[model samples]
Target: MDKISRLRGFRDIWKDELEKLRKIEEVARKYLNLLGFDELKVPILEKTELFVRSIGETTDIVQKEMFTFHDPSGDSVTLRPEATAGVVRAYIEASLFATQRITKLFTIGSMFRHERPQKGRFREFNQIDVEVFGSKGPLIDAELLWLISLILDELKVKNFEIEVNTVGCWECRKKFKEVFLSYIEKKLDHLCEDCKTRARRNPLRIFDCKKDECLFLTKDSPLLFENLCEECKIHFNKFLNYLIKFEVKVKHNERLVRGLDYYTKTVFEVKSSALGAQNAFIAGGRYDGLVKEMGGPDVPGIGFAIGLERLSLIVNTGNPKENLTVFIAFVDDKAREHLFRLVKQFVKSNIRVFYDPDSKSLKSQMRYAHALNADYAIIVGEEEIKNNIVSLRNMKTGEQKSYPNDLEYLIKDISYTK
Candidate 1:
């Protein structure tokens, strides 16, 4: 039979890569917790209408990218293309806002989409999502950007830039859309087919097209900044002033309307040059109206999602060296049983221990320990067993010593040696 294979846009993540991501997650959790945001586990699947209402009907995500289908009972369900909608749904259904005036949530998990697979784009990918509710102050926006700066510094991701803009609220967005449509109406036939469709339905999305022709066509298109209402302009200006106080520099891109239709007021993206064309490692903005649209109370919200796959590429995710582990090798069945019992003791004391179960030759066992890059190798042989002692070899310095067979005592010895 042919070997089973993974579907397109999906692959397994092995140990070395997973270890790097795990370390990054640990650091992320620490800073997010320190910032007063609580971790939330949002489900992978949600009702279809939830997204249609929040992400918008004409957006590319809902029309083409979403992985949606009907179940046995024939209710439309979708694997989440992004996290914010599900997060908002949870915020409402669980009544999280009622308990606390402000809800700060962070989620790290898999997101699904049906986009073409490339270097960083995948059918199934992971994202670190952060959301804040009940606050619309421009200071909150600056603070979130500062949080992103901290995470990037901690991970040693040096080459990156923050691109920001404002899409305005419903009122100003409507006015801009009418103006944008007129500018592009005469030139629609020259744009990409997808942009042509978007021109008729949702013109703001034309700014997101990657085609050179489409980009040229929209080069002189109306800037949202020029059309911003007095209220939005003031809010955006105050946001920029706050960002300056935090020393978070940003490039003002008039065309930085994010892919999602829900964004309003402020939007930002973190891009890296390491990954070609698809370079955005993180993007998000304020979706002040999404809460009520998803059947929740009227509340302003803001959030961002970082793509871990792309992040792993640019960030210096070093391969961990297992320097604190020990490998135990036994010479006989009697020795195996005795050493196995001591393994539990090492674990209880928070020491890492591993053993070869086959009771292999001493020379072969030593090679296995070296492969693991162990700090010490504990050899249990008939002679050492008879003497109620064990031979310890330091893999690093090529030193050997005889210590009491008790792991509790050896734990202290190992600590002192370091």
Candidate 2:
């Protein structure tokens, strides 16, 4: 029979990689907490309509990438392609909008999508999502950007640029989309099929198109800044002023339309030169109308999400943690019984211990101990068991010491050594 193979675009995050991911998550959680954003968790599954309503009917996520299935009860369910929609749903369902004045939330989890996976994109990937509700101003936008800055700095990811934009409120967007699409429509035939389709349903998305010809066609297309309404212009300018005040570096990118339909203004993405053409490692923006759309009162919100897998790749430490802290090796079956009891005692005391069941030779056991990178190799032989003592060998230093069967004392010594 052929060997069973893992699925493409999805692979096991083995111990070493998981350790790196854990470190990244820990740092992210600490940073978010320090910023006064409480941790929040939203389920991976959500009603299909939640995404359709928030992400928009025209986007690829809803039309193509979503993993939608019908439940046995004849209801439509979807593996959330992103977290923001489910987050908005939670805010509305729990009535958090009315209860909390400034509900800042941070989430970390897997999101599913069906896109053809590549270097940074995958079928199942993790994201660190943040959402700030009930506040609207340039100061808040700057604060979020600064938070992102701190996260990237903590990870030591130095080569990243901040690209910012404002997709003005609904009133200004209607006019900008009209003018922007008209200029691009003249060159529509030059664009790819995806761009052509988006032109009709979501013209703003054309700016975000990755197709070679589509990118070229949108090179000189009218910018969204020129068509901003008085209110949008004021809000965007104030945001720029705040960015200057906070000393956050930002580049005006008219093309930064954060994909989601709910985004009203202040969209931004952190791009890295290390990741070639697909440079975004983190992206987010303001969604002032999402609350109202999700059946809550009108509330403005903004937040960002960092791609965990991509961040892990860029921030890998290359060191794998050892499985066992101490290995209990016995010389004979008689010694094994005593060692087994000692192993149980160590386990009960929360010590990381391992042992080979087979009565192997002393040489083989030592080899296994070295292979496992055990800190201490506790040797229990007939002689040692007779005296109610064990010989502890430090694998790295080739030092040895005899200790009584009191596992607690042994563990304390090992902890100090570590």
lDDT of each: 0.88, 0.85
lDDT of 1: 0.88
- Model 1: which residue pairs collide? none
- lDDT string, candidate 1, 4-90, tens digits: 999889879988778878877888898899999999898898899988889988777899999999988999999999999988988
Q: Candidate 2's residue-wise lDDT over 321-350, tens digit each?
A: 544488889898878778657888888766
Error of 2 at 370 (Å): 1.0
TM per prediction? 0.92, 0.92
Query: How many clashing pairs per prediction, in order?
Result: 0, 0
RMSD of each: 2.2, 2.3
